[model samples]
Target: MVTAMASLPHIDNPVKLAVKDVAISYGGRTVLESVTFDVHEHEIFGIIGPANSGKTSFLKTLNRMDIFNPSMTFTGQITFNDRDIRKWRNVYSLRKRIGVVFPLPVGLPLTVYENVALAPRLSGVTGKADLDIIVERCLERAALWDEVKDRLDSLGSLLSGGQQQRLTIARALSQEPELLMLDEFSIAVDPVTTMRIEDVLKKLKKEMTIVLVTNLVQQARRLADRMALFLDGEVVEVGITEDLFAGQVKDQRTKDYLDGRFG
Candidate 1:
């Protein structure tokens, strides 16, 4: 219910996530090799790649989704909060701190309010008044409150494309996650709505660390403080957004890709 700006504590170690010499394989075919990176607190870190370049696979590794793939094998360390992610207090607890928004909106059978409140309720928030406040704050943060305020009782499937996407974002935000992973969030929405969502992300990044995976070069250039280019299952380059686009990357592959010669 508290709509105040999120107060981040001053810690000596500020990085939120770190991947250290990590490698992943499926059916003995390597998909990621020697991937290494650090995601700082409250910053937007963008990942860009062409199709089948392991962008989504790397994201799945962050939340331990690789465990679900029977053919997937992981090596090396993925550290979160200075501790190995595998050693985190619990997988579920780690997931609660990191939320994910996928490319398309998923319709729930419940009404809009229930859809947003379901996770919070599972987390032991049962008070009606508290649920109302959380839902309103989340919707407002996602920039959907104004449009859906009068339709709180409507089924989630009743929303338009843009509205449903925003609703999914609102649902994710209701958990108050410290890190938000957005995988092609704007791909399914209209241009105007995508811009709105981008603006919302800019505001949200003031409080949460945002990891964005998008195929659009422009989107990464516009919103990212830092960026990583992935190709052939490896990180080709990573640096400040302006630096990456300024023809300063050391890797030939990255430079070529940025110059529209290759991907």
Candidate 2:
């Protein structure tokens, strides 16, 4: 089981997610296999890989999103809080605890305020006062509050691309998730917005474990404490982010990918 060595304080934190010998398939055709890793609490664990390497597919499996795809099949153990995810009786309950952000923002048809409040309301957090607090707090966490506080009643779809992306993050935060998984979140946003969101992520890791699957190798280096390099549907290496950059890697491909030689 190859895995990264955790950097201080974060190493002391308990594991928030664990995946062992995991494999994925589509219509019996294997896409990824023998994957294993643990995401420690309150830390950013990055997965860097080139396209079609199964990075996004792997993240979907963690939240059990496979249930929505009839052709997708998976085998292996995935656990959260030491309980196998496959053993969970309620799929929605599992998802609520593990939020996901896609490569591109998908804004709801509802108002800005409603988008952030929808999850809590569905979870039974009703009272207007309570909803207000939850909505504001989530927006604040996503760094969208100040920009849209006055436009709360506007439709989320009406927000600019960057604002909508942040709105997506705010909606995820509304779930009050224990683990947040972002799959190429900056793909559609501008560099400025990407940096802003990255800054927000740094602060957010203090509140929840984060799994960041990005194609940008430098982005991983800047934010990840520990990370894994995935290529051709395999994890080539896992180590402290700097250690990999410093050439402390078992696979030459790992250093090559990090150095922009390929990937």
Candidate 3:
């Protein structure tokens, strides 16, 4: 059953990520414009919009992933844990604290155990016994342990699409990130697998902040503590999920989208 945001207990958590007047551009064309929002600690913040609405573009900026593209340009400020991202001397260190999962699974051509262990190993976990525990713990959290525990030595790429996605998630979990971002996570996943991952996310929010960028509004409603609706590179509305769906939206465009009038 889906859990509505309105029914969830409210916690006065401190801000984990703050985006202020943030905008993104590529080769002189603006992708997102002047977006501002605060994601509270341990809350699931959902970003929803139609195609080309700049949702993914904005997600990339959270951990400075946009820097990989020379053509990408950013304006305004994005702060993580109250510190400006621009001042972070080691971008890798910043990324270590933030995990990201993309629309499709990109499993490395390595065994499932090796795939999940890679992150912890890079972080200096050298003891064999410690890596074993970390790998099993993360895979369990990803809802994949029961299915893959016996096949830990099997190549990750050989798994089914849904299983590969779960493996990718397990890899991300190995980082034990302060913030976890998922961009269209259900796109390639089966419905059952999606539901299983959703359950994992529900439990995960108790430990870390989450940023979910999805086109599925219902998914946002089920998982978000607060949501922002983006349209045509602009934020149309942002509010408690229930308020946005209660037919009393401040913006008519928001109501239109919610009512299925148009994307």
Candidate 4:
């Protein structure tokens, strides 16, 4: 059975991700400073902040995507599924368990079916029948199966902006990740499509943890079980979604941001 938003599990649930004193820098410039939080299993954890607040940088670190940058530096401990990420021998294997979707739709030039099947194929599932089932299941979970079922053979890049974003989500779901991170997923998506994806996320939380980085406070309020508010590279506050918005914040900055006082 799918859990409803109103009855979502409490923040005290077992932690899926534990970030302790995490800090990141590019070259000599600090991006995130001493951030710490816990993401409960099977819950939607929202990260909200203005541009350049290190929201995306933090998300990348969760999956070790920051390794692509030669100048990137990180300090502190990030543990996933009770194991320290820094000590992981296979970063690629770690990433396969943590899926990520970026702000913009980055659809591969391949067909819609291929786009969803690529990851599974890379993981060595080459059976045609198995790939077909995986592709259909992922697309259906992303709320995109019906729209693209007829055009599975069509190029992914040929889809509209909203469709392409959903396609990216389907591709991410294909990995069957233990945790899923979405960075400003609604930016390029239409309002209707955004709501549809949000519904998908609500259903998905029953299966895996979600880290949602969004600038829209209301969006966070609607989907997040709890949230951490970021400002100037710091975690200003973290608490239950309703309690935070109900004016039970720890810092003035948090209340200010929630009240539209400032970014």
Q: For candidate 2, give the lDDT.
A: 0.90
lDDT leader: 4
**Count of backbone clashes, every candidate in sequence:** 0, 0, 0, 0
The runs of at least 3 residues in candidate 2 whose Cα sits more than 4 Å from the true structure, single-residue gaps closed, are 1-7
lDDT of candidate 1 vs native?
0.86
Candidate 1: give the clashing pairs.
Answer: none
Against the reference, the lDDT scores of all candidates come to 0.86, 0.90, 0.90, 0.92
**CA lDDT, candidate 3, residue 213:** 91
Candidate 1 per-residue lDDT, tens place, 23-102, comes to 88899999889888888898889999898888888888888887788898788899887889888768888888788888
lDDT of 4 by residue, 40-109 (tens): 9989999999999999889888888888998987899999989999898999999999998989999999
User: Model 3, residue 83: displacement in angstroms?
Assistant: 0.5
Candidate 4 segments whose C-alpha is farther than 4 A from its true place: 1-8
Query: Would you list the clashing residue pairs of candidate 2?
Result: none
Residue 207 lDDT (model 1): 87
If the candidates were sorted by their TM-score against the true structure, best first, what order would they fall in? 2, 4, 3, 1
The ten-residue window of minimal lDDT in model 3 covers: 1-10
Listed in order, each prediction's TM-score against the native is: 0.92, 0.96, 0.95, 0.96
Pairs with steric clashes in candidate 3:
none
lDDT of 1 at 234: 92
